[model samples]
Target: MRPVFRLLSDELIERIISQARDILCDLGMEIHNDGVLSMLSDHGASVDSEKMHVYFTADIIDKALETAPDSVKLFDVMGRQTHDLTDHNVYFTPGSAAINILDPLSGEIRKPLTADYVEYAKLVSRLDNIASQSTAFIPSDVHEKISDSYRLFLSLLYCEKPVVTGAFTIDAFNVMKDLQLAVRGSADALKEKPLTIFSCCPTAPLKWSDVTSQNLVDCAKHFIPVEYISMPLSGFMAPVTLVGSLVQHTAETLSGVVLSQLTQPGTPIIYGGSPAAFDIRFETTPMGAVETQMMDCAYNEIGKYLNLPTQAYIALSDAKKLDAQAGLETSMGATLAALAGINNISGPGMLDFESCQSLEKLVVDNEICGMTLRLARGIEPKEDFPAIPIFEELLREKHLLIANHTRKHLRDEHYFPGRVIDRANSSRWEEEGSLTIGDRAKSEIARLQGEYEPSGLSGDILAEMTRLMRAEAARFGMARLPHEDL
Candidate 1:
């Protein structure tokens, strides 16, 4: 059997699901969106329009679960399969919609511009461990109305990989779909092999605003895959116990699934979250805590049990500085999530409790991702073990690298060495300037930035994307899109 781990037993999982159902059926959720309230009410769900509390029946959720697809194939711009979101595999990408970029040289956090988004896209496309790219940071220089579209447009222009992104407004989301159509040549063509995954999240205490619900609704209507990120802060927004937090997460995600499928049966939806343990001392959401990783595996267990694709915020650290703590936390969090078989793991390159993004940290996290995947693969023993014969064969060679046994299996059996990880002796290390991991990481992203070449968009598609941006800008009383190239 393939390797996997879990925290909830079959009975325990059933109970959690039962409690989630009770939470929805009993307490219900506050729906701020009139359209979403109507959509649920028109279906079998009960809606209280005056109080805006909508209660979903277990039957509606069960139906949604039955109709949701078990696997989704996402493709790169070149039309190659990038990731298949299934229980057996995992994919890593950076966190989306970050507003600040940490400068590698100065160690200063600053607002990102359009050029910065292009650079971030290029960096992600070159990282082998990142299966896809996100609109990593929002550019502050652009008009508030068009910033979302601008970031995605740059990602589409530069990232050769599949994209993980979202929309802030319904209008922006429509433009995103238009951009997808422009890239794939037609609407039907875009659906054939999707090049992007859209995400939307509920406000943790069982609240759904119009934008969040509408994003899922739009995704369902367009046949686009959507993921619900249900973030609950334990001890603050949710009950302090881990089980209670899991129940809250389950309820919010299941609600999204039901609403999406109710809008369009057979719409693809992912059950995922970045549930946090509210740090009482600091009043912060520590993304790197042991409880956070534990929660990662736990929610994944529930999602996989339901045969739904899973995602979580792992492969990250809350360290304000990129130091040993960052490496230690990142290594542990990412490995646990990978072993748990999450499909799409985000939060790489995030720091300061995910309020900041660092390209240098991204370089380091890329290496962390590689090693974690290697660990996840586990050992492959093709034949029965004979300890005596193995020992005798090893005794024949003073150095194993010269042995045929070593020459044949070494590359596949061992992780390819990481450049940032220090494995050299003191003398050799001192000869190399004794650079720290962060120092080496800074150099790495700098080198990549120097040599990276972004894949270009087709002329026709590029023109269409420009036109969409310009028209969106016109809504804000601007004549043309900012940073437009003719």
Candidate 2:
């Protein structure tokens, strides 16, 4: 049996859902988009036009839940399926939309450029444990208007893995969608084999802004899967208690589900969020806080209870650097998230409360992810049920070094981590020069940069993607896109 972690029981989850429904029915949510308000109103939800508030009934919530897909499949640029987001399956991805990156050489955080993003994509393409790549950071070299699509463009050009990305504006969605079509060859083919998952966030305390609400509608219209990023800061924008924060999260996410389903029934969505536990003393929201990890695991239970796939921004740190705090928080969160069976775990390489990305942290976290995934697999009988034979051979041979069973099961039963994890003896380690984790990670990054290969997309497809990006860049007053080699 796989290892399982649960924070809420069946009764508690039911009560949480009940209370959330009551909130949607009574407190309601303020939707800033008039189009969404009209759509909900037409669909029989209670909408107040002037106030732009819409109330959802139990019937509406149930209908939305019924129509939303239980699983979302993701494919790479080659149309090869990468993830089947269902059951207790877990996948790791880099945390997204960081405004800054941790500079490896300077040991400081600063704005990233186009080359930084390209290196990031190349590194993620080589990370074995990270199942997908995110538009990890914003490159300041591009204009603000095209920043969203520009990241997506670079990801598609540099990596073959499926992307976890989003658009900041309604217009950017069209460009991002066109980039995917350029690779998939048609709208239907793109829909049939989704190349990316967009993250649509809702504001805290049960509200949806105009841009995010429209993004939800647009994604549904185009058959793109979305993960609702509900960020409710506890004791600040949300309630002081974990239960209260969950109620707010559920209300916000359920409202998104209703909107997406109404826009297009059977639209895929992951019941996801990035809620944090508030520290009153420091006046900060810590994703590594035990309460935050508990909430993430608890919400996954809620999502599974409703029979939908789930995602979380757990397994990352609030620390500014790749120090002990970063390792402690990131590893703990990753362990809990994996045991809880989060379908899409989006947090690795993220730091400083999700505002910064670190390549060094990413390589280290890849090892952490590998360990957690192994733990999630648990221990099962692997054709050794009749163990007497193996033990008898061990006694006779004095070792199992040359045993067939040992040779057959070695790779499957053990996870041999990369050079980042040290397993050498003191003498050997001293002989080779004792490198710190940071040093090993930097070496791994450089090695990956050298070993990186082109994405192998056809020349025609590459030209089309470039043409689309150039057109969007021109609109934002950029005469030449940075990183022409990309």
lDDT of 2 at 251: 86
Q: All models: lDDT?
A: 0.83, 0.93
Among all candidates shown, the one with the greatest TM-score: 2
Candidate 2 TM-score versus the reference: 0.99
RMSD of each: 2.1, 0.9
TM-scores of all predicted structures: 0.95, 0.99
What's the residue-level lDDT of 178 in candidate 2? 97
lDDT computed for candidate 1:
0.83
Off by over 4 Å in 1: 383-398, 402-405, 478-486
In model 2, how many backbone clashes occur?
A: 0
